[model samples]
Target: MQVFTQDDVLRFIYNEVDAKEKKSIEDALRLNPSLLTLYTELKEVVAKLGNAKMEPDNSTIDLIMAHSAASKMETSH
Candidate 1:
């Protein structure tokens, strides 16, 4: 009867747990409503994060390129 923590649930969500721990968590999830709710919420968050897009804007990219070109010119001289 191991009490799973939020960290344990997170590892389970990411498939970082071993087979035995995975089975235990699955069993707990079936019998414990609270754990199941946590799992569901965390899983949704993980899914949303997976779908999230993050990239530098065009201005940031242009700034980086400009800096790189300036550095290259300084070195070549």
Candidate 2:
């Protein structure tokens, strides 16, 4: 099995890579003890990023619409 780098783990989490590559990396993770430490760190980073909330789901669309409308109105005026 091949070893995974942090970039590989991140890409996997973000779905940047396809399922086939993901499975290969996962298999490597399961078989390699040394990969565990790097995997743990990557997992932490992924968790932190996941926890990030730049804006609430409901308000984001509303905010965008409001801003877009306002910009249009300003342009017309």
Candidate 3:
């Protein structure tokens, strides 16, 4: 009857929990609808994040560089 938090679910998702906690979360996931729902949503988010591109695209980098160059010009004047 231990209540699990979102952090616990996240830890479970990332396999950061110990064996005992993992078992507890698995049991809770089966018996608790809300916890299961949270787990499912978090799992999807984790998957999406895992597949997400971590780097900014070329255009974005160019824009940032342009902005920085403009700032430097203004400061020099």
Candidate 4:
């Protein structure tokens, strides 16, 4: 039985863990109250992010492109 740390729980919640580790984390989640609470909060955040509709406006994109072009020119020089 592996005792997962907070980082491990976070990785599991974010789908960053491997299948084997995910199974381990899932088993721990079932019996750990604190991990369950943390998972719930992180899951809610992920859900909210998934529902988010964010798009940069044309002006913002232009500014970013201009900055990128300038940086490239500076590096090339």
Candidate 5:
């Protein structure tokens, strides 16, 4: 079995990769216990972060929108 890459971890999280790849990641994790634990811990932290609510800054949002619009126009041209 080959060593797993960070991309595999991301794909495992998102379920975007094939079963063969998923199984490969699992097999790699079986050999590297630390990675397996890190994966589980980080996923739990991310889940909690997602569940936690935070207020968005209106000014920051407007600035981001303006910048995105400007970038889009530049790209389209």
Candidate 6:
């Protein structure tokens, strides 16, 4: 039996694991309470990340652009 580590869990969550490894993890998830909990938590996090918008809103973008323009003006003078 291969020992699953954090990296393996992450890979499984991301669908980066090979078919055999994925099957192994899926099997473990059924029998191991702790692994199931970890998988559930990771799935939630991944779902949240999928819905997350990291880009700054228009107002913030405007503020940053204005600040950048101001800095350029100060440096050129």
Give the candidate number with the greatest lDDT: 1
Instruction: For candidate 6, write residues 1-77 as lDDT tens digits.
Output: 66788778889999999999999998988888888898899899889889767776899989999999999999999
Scanning candidate 2 in windows of ten residues, the lowest lDDT window is 1-10
- Model 2, 1-77: lDDT tens per residue? 56678788778767888888989988887887767667777778878878777756988889999999999999999
TM-score: which candidate is best?
1
Clashing pairs in 3: none
At residue 36, candidate 3 shows an lDDT of 95
Note the Cα lDDT for every prediction shown: 0.95, 0.81, 0.93, 0.89, 0.82, 0.89
lDDT for residue 39 in candidate 5, whole number 0-100: 77
Candidate 3 scores a C-alpha RMSD against the true structure in Å of 5.6
Could you give candidate 4's per-residue lDDT for residues 1-77 as a string of tens digits?
67888888888877899999999899999999998898898889888899778888999999999999999999999
lDDT of 3 by residue, 1-77 (tens): 99999999988999999999999999999999999999999899889888766787899999999999999999999
RMSD of 2: 4.1
Q: What is the Å distance of residue 40 in model 1 from its true position?
A: 0.4
- What ranking of all candidate models by lDDT puts the best one first? 1, 3, 4, 6, 5, 2
TM-score of each: 0.65, 0.59, 0.64, 0.64, 0.55, 0.63
Candidate 4 residues lying further than 4 Å off, grouped into runs, are 56-77
Candidate 5 TM-score over all chains jointly: 0.55
Q: What are the per-residue Cα lDDT tens digits for candidate 1 across 1-77?
A: 88999899999999999999999999999998999999999999889998778898999999999999999999999
Candidate 1 clash figure, as a count: 0
Which runs in model 5 stand beyond 4 Å of their true positions?
Answer: 53-77
Candidate 4's TM-score reads: 0.64
What 10-residue stretch in candidate 5 is worst by lDDT?
1-10
